[model samples]
Target: MRFLLAIICCKLLRLALRLLGRGGTALPGQVALRICPDMLSRLSRGVRVAVVTGTNGKTTTCRMLEKMLRDAGEDCFANRSGSNLERGITADFVSNADIFGRPRRRLAVIECDEAAFRRVCGELAPAVCVVTNVFRDQLDRYGEVTHTLGAIREGLDRAAHATVCLNADCSLTASLAADAPDRVRFFGVDAPLGGAAAVSDAPRCIFCGAQYEYDYHTFAHLGGFRCPKCGYSRTEPDVAVVSVGALTSEGSAAEVRIDGELFDVAVGLPGGYNLYNAAAALSAATALGVERRSAVRSLAHMESGFGRMERFEIGGTRITMVLVKNPAGCDRAIDYLRSLSGECTAVFCLNDNAADGTDVSWIWDAGFERLFDAGGAELRLIVSGERADDMRLRLKYAGADEGDIRVLRSQDELLEAVTSAGGEVCILPTYTAMLPLRAALAARCGRKEFWK
Candidate 1:
């Protein structure tokens, strides 16, 4: 009775919140979990669930998985816009079920935080789990990348029967396979990405503490990585991006080999990191019993989720918003900026909110210097947010000319600058900062409100 009451109340609250133009991802779940502590597990029973947890790409990967499942004609739902915590996930489960607490959908794709995975998995015991990749993120929250890995390891240990999809190129993520080798599936790029590698988040082996050797580098630390001392190496991927045929600011095309089958894959999203997400999603789909061809076909139609490289047009300017929370993710966003073919306006938003690591020191670790150098003198830079001045200072040190740097402290000013920029505008904002900008843009541009 408590479970049913929790579900019904949370559903009504979610509806109420949506009607008020508010995002209903977390609070409803929080209230529901308080009403029934075991609500998540009760609601999750008998569902084929795929839980994706990692430092990055969880949302996009889950987006792909959900789409593939929907295309495969399965009744499915996901934690689309909510918090990715125990409570938020529970709330999502509640919302998908009937008032009697019976599931309307038999499949789910859940995006979970690394810190919350262990606690949540014990209840859900998902049929498939995908660890996108581990990076040094929110040091205040997760302590270290290894600690994040340990958390996921614990989750996998609890769900021993779940098919685990690991990233072969990421040493930190690939190491998890050792815990569940028989049930693990690997995904990664087959050949070198041919760029100077960014500073590796995992420079030493997780097991031996010895420096790693790479056959080639794709972007950050991801590549053909191998440990010499203990002989831990990247296993050949079951879902491999054999070659990226073309990568542009628009999208990317690649030849993806899934298991023993090869298919030409084209992702509608930009950036090389997105390629990894596509590969990871395909691997997870196959693990969840979706056909490989269907998964590959779905990849061609996948759109960017909320703030992970989402694009919009407003007031005559084209704006692409990419969310950056850590040094590695920031550097990748900067790399995407550096890849633009012509001059464009760049907006950098930094916030020290709790969701975005309180310690903003991670920005110093990104390749901002390289980004500024590549942008040349013509690039216009705008810094906005709670820490706009700090971002501006960081840019000045990154080789941005003083004359080209502008600071917009207000949302109206920032939006005006973006709309009046007269060309392609790229906005890179930290977690909290992205929220208001996304809301404002959506309101003016006729896009669906985040809650809806």
Candidate 2:
């Protein structure tokens, strides 16, 4: 009876919030948990859940996997609003359940926060868990990358029966396989990405204190890495991107080897980092029993979710908004900007709000200097949000001309600059800053509200 009451209350709260024109992704779950502490565990009892957690790419990978399940004619739901906390995850499960506390869908793709994974994973008891690569993110909240790794490892300890999908390129992520050797499945890119390595979040070996040697590097510390002292090396992935064909502004084309069968995969997203995400999604999908071909084909039709490579157009200008939180994600956004052929304007919106991480010092580690060096005179810069001046100063340090950098704090000012720019514009904003800006752009472009 308590479980049923919790479901009813959650549904009612969600309805009220929707009527009030709000997303209501987290609070409903928080209130429901207060009513029934074990609400997620009860609601997720019969569901076959697939949990995706890591520093980045969780949302994108979930979307891709959800699409794959749907294309295979399986009814599945995901936490699409980007509320990854325990409360938010519970809220999504409640929303997907009937008034009697029965799940309407048996398949779930949940994106969980790394810190919250310890509390939520055991409750959900997912069938497949995908740990997208780990990096230095939310230093104030998660402390260090190793701490984040420990949190995930603890979560995996609770869900022992779940098949773990590990990133073979990320030594920190691949280390989790030690706990679940028999159930581990690996995914990564095999070819070198051909760029000088950026600042590595995991430079030293996770198993040993020794420095790692790489035969080829994809980016950051992710690649063919081996510890000379401990003999810990990247294991051959079950799913791998053997070669990258093209990385255009539209998307990427690559040849992926999935369980010994090669398939030409086209991911409808920009940047090389997405290849890792694609491989992760395919790995998770196959683990969930979806056919390999159906899973591979779904990547080409993936729609960008929320602020992750979400696109909008106003009059003559086209704007792509990407949510940047950590150094690795920021560098990938810059790489996408550098790939543009003609004149382009890049906007960086940073906020030090709790959700965006109180410590904004991670920007110093990002490869912002590459933008000025590679883009040269073809790029225009705009900085906005609560920490616009800090971004402006950071750009100055990155070799951006002081005169070319525009600081537009107001939403009207930022929107006007985007509409008047008359070319392709890429706006990279942190978590909190992305909300209002994305809503404004969605309204102007006639796109549906993010909640819808």
Candidate 3:
């Protein structure tokens, strides 16, 4: 009854949203109450669910999984708009249901929030659950990265029988391999260039409480290593990123050897970090029997969502918008930026909203060091949004020259600053700040390749 009511409410909300000239998310809470007053039990049908959860790359990873599934001729229902919570997931399932309240797809791919995994997973038992990584994020909301990792751990514990995809490169994720060895499949990137790059590493082990050694360090502490004391290390990736050859500011062209044949591909998204994401998705899809070549080709045509490594041409200059919500991601973005040369301007915006952590202190850990390491005087930083001052201070703390940093109180002004700054601007902002920045750039630049 609860599931049925929710389905009815979702239809009513869809109608109300259309009539009110708003998105489906604009519906009031009472509408859901009116429709779904009972428990949502429809999760137990023949419907298969696959959940992707992590700190930084959940959206991208989930997006890839969704596409691969669809390409494999599976009718899939996915949370493309990033409604990872109960409400968002419910809205998606409810709105996409048939007349009898059955889903229109053979499977579902949902991006579950790091902090809300247990709660959301409780509603839907996924046949496959992928944990991207547990990185330091939103300390105010989650306290520590462990809190988010704990949520995934809790879900994995309960759904012990589910096929678990863990990141062998991520220390925290690799640790889970020991706990649920029978159900977990570890996928990692063999960072052939790991020793040469300046990257961050995850510190201690969750089990034995000792520092894990790095055989190689991927970006921001994710890499090959093991704990000597407790023997916690990357336990042989089922799918390892064997080669991440050349990727420039323009895009990346590389090959991942799957089943002896190196599937040659070029991805529009910048960063080998993305290749890592693609590799993980490939592993999950292969586990589900998606054709390797079709999945490989499908990746080249992916559309950028929000500010997640999306590039566009503006005023005859090509600019890429990379969202940096935490230290690991910010570091990866900058590292990828260094992979190119040419004048690049950037807008760094922050928001301490509920979605963004109220504690803006996490910015300190974001390796603002990279912006400076790339050469301080060369890169000018435009700080914007509610936490503009915070961004400014963080840059200064990283020993950035005051002349190189400018703080703009308004998001609109940030765009104006970038336009007039004279270079290809790389807009780096948090989740809330990304849309407004995108809107402002789209208005003048008139780029629609990523608008939808």
Candidate 4:
């Protein structure tokens, strides 16, 4: 009776929120879980599930895997609303189930928050789990990167039956494979990207306290890393990018080796970090028994999910918005911005809300210095959101002229600034700030609301 009530209430609340023009991704599931605390476990039974959990690429990885499954004629649902917590995931499952708590679709792709993974993983008992690289993120909430890693490891402990897909390039992520050795599959880039290295989140070995030596670094702490003391090293990946081809502002093409067979894959997303996402998604798809060739073909047509390299156009201005949460992601966004040619305006929107992490100190660690150093196109600067002043100050410290930075505090001011800006525009916003700013951009451009 409680299960039935939970399902009915969740559906009704979702409908109510939709009618009220709200996303209704998390609250309905929260209410449903209150009515039945074990609702997720009960509802997830008899379903084939793949859960993607980590700091950076969870949502994109889930999106890619979900698309691969759908392209192969398997009906699957995911928490596409960017609500990755327990409540939001529960809401999605309930919405896809009937009043009797039976799933309409047997297959599901879920993106789980790292902190929530420990609590949600056992309940979902996913057939396949992918852990995209771990980096320092939400320090106020998760404390440290190691703590975030511990949370994911605990989640894996609960998911004994899962076929784990790990990033062989990330030392912190590769460490988790020890928990489920026989069932583990690895993916990574075989060649170095030859970019300037930023401060590494995992500078020393997780197993031993000794500093790590790199054969070459892709960016941040990822790439071929070897611990001199304990002799720990990167494992040979089952799926790897053997060579990188053309990388344009639109997308990237690479030669990938999947299970010893080479296939030229063109990813529909920009940035080298997305190559890791593609490899992770392909690893998860293969684990789920999806055809390798069909999954590889799906990467060429992947639509951007939410704020990850999402593009919009307003009044002759081409705008690209990338969500920046931590140093690693911020550095990658900066790399993408550097890749662009011609004149462009760069906007950094930051908020110190609870959801955005109260500590804005991570901005200091991000490579804002590289943006102003040299190279790239002619760039203009705009800072907005609740912490607009802080962003401006950070850019100043990164060697920007104080007069060149425009501080726009309100949404109206930001929208006006963006629309009036000349040439291409790139906006990087923290989590809480991205919501309203993206909404305003969508409204101005006639794009669909995020919920749709």
Clashes of 3: 6
lDDT of 4 by residue, 191-216 (tens): 87655575368989899889999988
Clashing pairs in 2: none
lDDT of 3 by residue, 1-452 (tens): 66566666677767676676555442432356355633233633667888888887888988888888888788887877656766666666665677467767768887888766886666677788888888778777776666777778887876655788888888877777666888777777776543223334357777887877777776776777778898766777776667777776555677676655667777666677887788778777876777888888878877666578776566665667898877778878777665556566766888878777688887776666665564433565778888888788888888778777888886557666776666667778787787667766766666652313
lDDT of 2 at 158: 90
lDDT of 2 at 118: 84
Candidate 1 Cα outliers beyond 4 Å, as residue runs = 194-196, 374-377
Question: What would you estimate as the lDDT of candidate 3?
Answer: 0.72
Worst 10 residues of 1 by lDDT: 370-379
For all predictions, the C-alpha RMSD in Å is: 1.4, 1.1, 2.9, 1.0
Model 2 TM-score (2 dp): 0.98
Clash list (residue pairs), candidate 1: none
Q: What would the per-residue lDDT of candidate 1 be over residues 1-452, giving only the tens digit for each residue?
A: 89878888899888888888787668889889889998888888888889999988999999998999899887899998848999889888887888988899999999999999998889998999999999899789889888888999999999877999999999999999888889999999987754448646899998999999988888689899899999999899999999888888778899999988899988888887789999999999988888888888888887887998999987678899999998878878877887886778999999999999898988888878877564343568899999988898888888888778899999999988888887789999998999989888877789996557
lDDT of 4 at 86: 97
Model 1 score (lDDT):
0.87
Model 3 residue 202 lDDT score: 58
Go through the candidates in order and give each one's C-alpha lDDT: 0.87, 0.90, 0.72, 0.91
Local accuracy of candidate 2 as per-residue lDDT tens digits, 1-452: 78878888888999999999999778899889999999899999999999999988999999999999999999999998888999989999988888888999999999999999988888999999999999888789889898999999999999878999999999999999998999999999999865447536988888778999998998788899999999999999999999999888789999999999999999998877889999999999999999999999999998887999998888889999999998988888877888887788999999999999989998998988888775443888899999998999999998888998999989899988988898899999998999998999899888888677
- Misplaced by over 4 Å in model 4 are none
